[model samples]
Target: MSDSKKADQKKAIVFLCDGTEEMEFTITVDVLRRAKVDVTVVGVNIAKEFALCSRGVKITPDEKFSESLSSGNYDAVVIPGGNGTASILGDHEGAKKLILEFYESKKIVAFICAGTLVAEKAGIPHKHTVTSYPAFKSELEKVYNYSEDRVVVDENVITSRGPGTTFLFALTIVEKLLNVKTVNSLKNEMLTCSSL
Candidate 1:
């Protein structure tokens, strides 16, 4: 494809990983790549090897956070749930800053399970509906001031519960970033899975 055609066709998605939930990160990566989105897995630390997920699976990142941030290009930022990943993202000044900047720019920001903690810590208002692991609801409720009963999508931010909702969360992000038609097609292709 030519530069203009590539630019017009590509939609960039960055997945920040540091011990993320294996299924959440892998499922999102797999589904988005299947849809032909330009997806990049960004390493949040100095380790060059694949990061180990909560389930003991290792995933190789596509690029380092330093490099991707320096490039200053991406259409969306996705965070996968894993307490370790969430804690690292919550404390990383650079990641938090970029997340806030992306949100301010009105780009899609998605988090699932414990990943929502990073968003809450980054100051995404609780008033913006959100859902996460039941154990973490109080943390989000305190910040956003709204108690969400189920999976919630507020504007460009999407949040879901735990492993049970991973597929739906991934599809929801796809639906938001691309379109409902693409999401429907993907769902139809993966007929075993239910719709969002």
Candidate 2:
């Protein structure tokens, strides 16, 4: 299928691994689904059917690492931050390849908090502004045009800070893959348009 055709579906893949931050992972998936995007939560850990998140919540993967690597139909790859980000970097070549493929295809490659480290390890150069957990500021600067913004959208790469910024991060994803109109409508319906 053509890239445009793939994009029109608004399909997303939320990569998850053991130790992923639950809020960032769930919120991104929730908001994307709310925008009518088809989201697949894929697990980087092939050994586990479900991921045990940072907050102790176990998340089932809709697809395994190998499955997601072969699908290649998603329009975006969303990474949620947490302690497991290092695991994603160190352990999952499938996730890394997926990130590289998404970027090379000009599709969205987004992550939050510590997830930026995984994106960095995946070899997507950050040419424009990006953000991540404040504690990783020094580290993010090495690979990105790092900033302190709650959320940053540069090129096809999207990023946000920690768990507190997950909502805004997801809304930004919605705005990028869908439209401002959709995001506005969602924010209004969710009573967060004015609140934020």
Candidate 3:
């Protein structure tokens, strides 16, 4: 693509590992792409060919995590949550490093459900308020100012509750990274409720 063409587009990368929440992963990517964002799916610590989701669904990543980091100039980095996904990514040095890189660069770092755990694990300071899956509230609250809102955007760190809230989470990212006009167009195209 021409530099001008690329400059006209918003790019995002979604990180996935084995046991990622299927809905959160899929919905976020779908919504962002529908908004005309260029979305790349990266597999972290999983086979280059595919990653098995929490429900046993399989997905092929567009690139490996390292490859994405090396070559991608994204507006945002997204993480979709699941029980195992949180545990694995939270402990991954690469994942943590990437989160810190994005955070430091003032780029959008978005997560949903248990994926919020990765923020605390990545050693982000506790100043940013956030929200996450209810089960992780206690742990995350110790670090972030916690909220029960379906979606929380504290500066560039955007977080959300869980699978059911994935669309709103993704839409919020679209609004922040792209524009409200794009988000409004996507909501109509995706047939989402206006209030959402």
What lDDT does each candidate get?
0.77, 0.83, 0.88
lDDT tens per residue, model 2, 1-91? 5777656777888888888899999989999999989898877763577888898898898977673364367789898899786566545
- The TM-score values for the models, in the order shown, are 0.90, 0.90, 0.94
List the lowest-lDDT window of 10 residues for candidate 1. Answer: 66-75
What stretches of model 3 exceed 4 Å from their correct place?
1-3, 67-72
Which 10 residues in a row give candidate 3 its minimum summed lDDT? 65-74
Best by TM-score: 3
Give the range of the ten consecutive residues with the poorest summed lDDT in model 2: 63-72
Cα lDDT of model 1 by residue, 1-196, tens digit: 6787767553555555657888878888877876767887887873557787787787888777762473246677888888877988898888888788778888888888899999977877656878888889877787774445446788988888888787787787778777888888888888835636
TM-score of candidate 3 against the unseen true structure: 0.94
> Which stretches in model 2 have alpha-carbon errors above 4 Å?
1-7, 67-72, 193-195
Residue-level lDDT tens digits of model 3 in 81-187: 99767888888898788888888888999989999999989877799999999999999888789999999999899999998899899999999988899889988
Better of 1 and 3 by TM-score: 3
